[model samples]
Target: MTSARIALVTGANQGLGRGLVEGLAARLGPDDLVLLTGRNAERVAGAVAHVAADPATRSRVAGRVLDVTDADAVARLAAELHDQYGGVDFVVSNASAMLTPDRSQSAQADDFIDVANGGALAVLRSFAPVLRAGGRLLVVASSLGTLGHLDPRLQPLFDGASLDEVEKAVESWRTALHTGTAEELGWPRWINVPSKVAQVAAVRAVAAERRDTDLPADRLIACVCPGLIDTALSRPWFTDFSGAQTPAQAATAVLDLLLTERVDPATYGELVRFGRVLDWHDGTPPQLPDGLLVN
Candidate 1:
């Protein structure tokens, strides 16, 4: 008998992460396994129970405690997957930290760069070796982080012809933020936008790196935007917003990318929003009501 396909999702206790796990559990083959991971053990356990409650998905769902920002924790998980399952077939880097109004500029920068950007990189880096050939990697990003929000001068760097250049561009933004020159450097003051931008760029870089190496040509690595879901992270702005989507609705978009029978190479490094490939590079910035969302 063939071994079961394995999928791992970070921050799977609640919100979009939970929805993604649930959707996968319901749709994946009966022999497949879905590992729902979170930073809190109790929360992860509860989420596992919730997903496992359904008889159809019960045997395929399990939970793990993982803090994506912690290198040791990530390494441990990767090692376990290697030993027990050979490798994972799908990895979803869904964990993220958002900036709150009370945070100082420095604090916000740390949360965005260190927590959000850094955490996603850690997940991808540590798990890369353990990702099965022809596997798929999905990084959850935001539309707010599109290059359209950046100054034209900086756009070239993020959209550079090579991964190395994109990495340098992301570093430049971080340096500007640390030195209090972000505004002068033409970076948005909003923490989420740049952080998500960096993530989207990182996806491109990873795909490029793998393409130039021995990894399978069919490996799918891409960033996806859930598009303003009404979750804890977006509650402040989403409560009064008319266009907010339920977490389940957002999860369907991600699930389609992960479980589809055919993998489209064109989407390997693009940001997909609402089932469409958003031209974030040249698209117009989204405008929301004042105070409805912070910059």
Candidate 2:
């Protein structure tokens, strides 16, 4: 018999998170289990039932309550998975916080610190070590976070830097924002750009740390931009949904990347879209069509 193929998705009660659960449900083997997690138990169970209602995924999906912001909870989940299954085969950090409706400075700052940085950072700290040999760690991020967005001086902060350094830079951004010096400090007015860049940098930093270990080649890990999807996260920012892909459509693309048997070394720790590793270093597409969700 084959080993149980275990996979987990964070913040999967709705939107792209739910779509990813359905996509994984359709692809996982009979013996495999895909855990869809959310902060609320009821919501997560509902999502699991809804996805499992489909005959193709009827027996393959389950739900768990996990609030990624709580480092203790994340650590416990990691320990539980390691003890129960020896480790996970695939994990996607998809539960990210977005700017709130009011879009107040404090709210945006909360999103950045709590969900974007704290949440993603916690997941990586806990799960990266518990990933099964040759497993995959896919961080859900936006193309807007690429290094190219930062001024040339700030770009070096992420390139080959340690996790501490990346985190320090993130803290510096927060400090600047609170002091109203963010713009003068070269931080973009659209804070998500810096938030995402730091988030992805943390991923790369973790991967680099793992490489120094004597452990046999570690898991396949990278940040993936799920493209412009018509979801709660993007709908508010964009007036047009015509150009956006359905959550399921975008989810399929991400699933394809996760389930691939082999990926080029260059793609590791890079920002990818639909299996294509993006040129995140210096930026690209000299010019982009206005109001389009190309990423």
Best by TM-score: 2
Tell me which residue pairs clash in candidate 2: none
For model 1, where is the 10-residue window of minimal lDDT?
A: 286-295
Report how far residue 185 has shifted in candidate 1, in Å.
1.7
RMSD of each: 2.9, 3.8
Provide the lDDT at 153 for model 1.
65
Give TM per candidate.
0.87, 0.90
**lDDT per residue (tens digit) for residues 35-99 in model 1:** 99988899999999988897757338889888887877898888888889898888899997765
* Residue-level lDDT tens digits of model 2 in 53-171: 88767337888999998989999998998998898988999887665434555437855577778778888889998888768888899887678878777788888878889878888
User: Residue 204 in model 2: shift from native, Å?
Assistant: 1.3
- Residue 43 lDDT (model 2): 97
